[model samples]
Target: MSAQESCLSLIKYFLFVFNLFFFVLGSLIFCFGIWILIDKTSFVSFVGLSFLPLQIWSKVLAVSGILTMGLALLGCVGALKELRCLLSLYFGMLLLLFATQITLGILISTQRVRVERSVQDIVKKTIQNYHADPEDTVAEESWDYVQFQLRCCGWHSPQDWFQVLILRGNESEAHRVPCSCYNSSSANDSAVFDKMIFPQLSRLSPLARPGPSTDLCVVSAKSHIYREGCAQSLQKWLHNNLISIVGVCLGISLFELGFMTLSIFLCRNLDYVYDRLARYR
Candidate 1:
């Protein structure tokens, strides 16, 4: 192969590699979206239709993933076949994808505060109704997972549960606290106490039971239950991971820009390669 032919071949290989990365990334995103949709154990399932935004976002991810894979195939064929029309279409799609990402980034930056507030409101309301209906096993189990994983009780504090119990005026549920609030080192211990029996048992004696000190259990449990709410924890997490998040976005944007430049260059030089091959024939 001549110098020009070799350069074109290298560019074609780069395009294939770049698109292949996107194909894999898109597939992973698509699979995650599918899991989010079908996984009944997740918090998303609890809210059902009320959580329309998340559901819609998941659908978008799945569709975008499929489109990305298709684009990868188009790019591969164009590079290999040296087809002008296919290359043009691939370039156009890349431009569209770039624009969409930039617009999404801008919108997120501008509306971040509003988005955060809305999320917090949703979280508060969800916690308030953590166990509103006994039939809602989905929501209840979801909350249980959150509390156990985050080591948190209610929205702001355990007092949130107290307020709800007062408003509910249900004697049976009065002293009930989520098993996740327990200080036990083992999850099994907490699981065992998740039932409503603890409150009744405490009422029976209300004194130290020697073995684990039942009277002190509430205090210890409160100690284990995170004092900061989920919203607050989320805020801290975002702050801490801001650098990583920005880096990932920047990497994606740069990756797209690089491929776009390569595609344009290839389109310009495609004819030269074809002419050289024609002469060889």
Candidate 2:
């Protein structure tokens, strides 16, 4: 065997190893994606709450990992079979997937931003009304009614109230309504009042119940703040992760295209060498 034969053998072995590595990696990533889609609640409870600003990072990472594994598997198959058609199909699928993700990410980000703005406005109006006439009997009464409903629903303290309040209006004044103010026996009046104003106040509850460290007894702007912050945080978190995943997918697709081109060049060179050697013989 000549030096050229040795080089060809080495190239073949390398492609075989690459194919196996990518096949396993792709399988694992596909499994992980299935897990994410299946146990979404578990993912939200464990990873979502822990990584506040980066909550969506895990999902994006999972997506990118899966896409990369897929591309690698395709490239390996194409190389092993010496099939140009397979290589072309692989590149096409990779590009299509990246484009689809980019489009979806843009749409979701836009919708989320709109929702955050609308929620913020409702919070602002409620706060403005509360503070504009803190001393007025009607205003105080309305504020008390809102606070009572929040507590009944589950808010426990001024701080909890505050979180909800700030979520509505970041700059709104903090009004503390004592628990004594709520009359459970007067269910009719409470129900009517809650129907009128508490809807906005209630909108600000966090997705997760704050731990024991959170003050459950207080009702203040903090509740509003937590609620608003969560909305804003969620949007930011999603955008960041989506951008990363899309970027990675684009990069991997380009890499696969490059590899396919290189493989074609190698095949052509091998064919030319074989033809020339046969003619000389």
Per-prediction TM-score to the true structure, in the order listed: 0.65, 0.39
Error of 1 at 40 (Å): 8.3
Candidate 1 clashes between residue pairs 3 or more apart in a chain or in different chains = none
**1-281: candidate 2 lDDT, tens digit per residue:** 67765665465456557656876776676666666555545544554221121224346656777766777776677656656566566656756765776687677677977866776565445434543442332332343444343333222223333334423434545554333233435443444334423332332235544322211132333223222223344445557798797788778667555555555544544665577579889
Per-residue error (Å), model 1, residue 176:
4.6
Q: Candidate 1 lDDT, tens digit per residue, 198-219?
A: 4424432426242421221222
TM-score of 1: 0.65
- Scored against the true structure, residue 79 in model 1 reaches a CA lDDT of 76
Worst 10 residues of 2 by lDDT: 48-57
The per-model lDDT (C-alpha) reads 0.65, 0.49
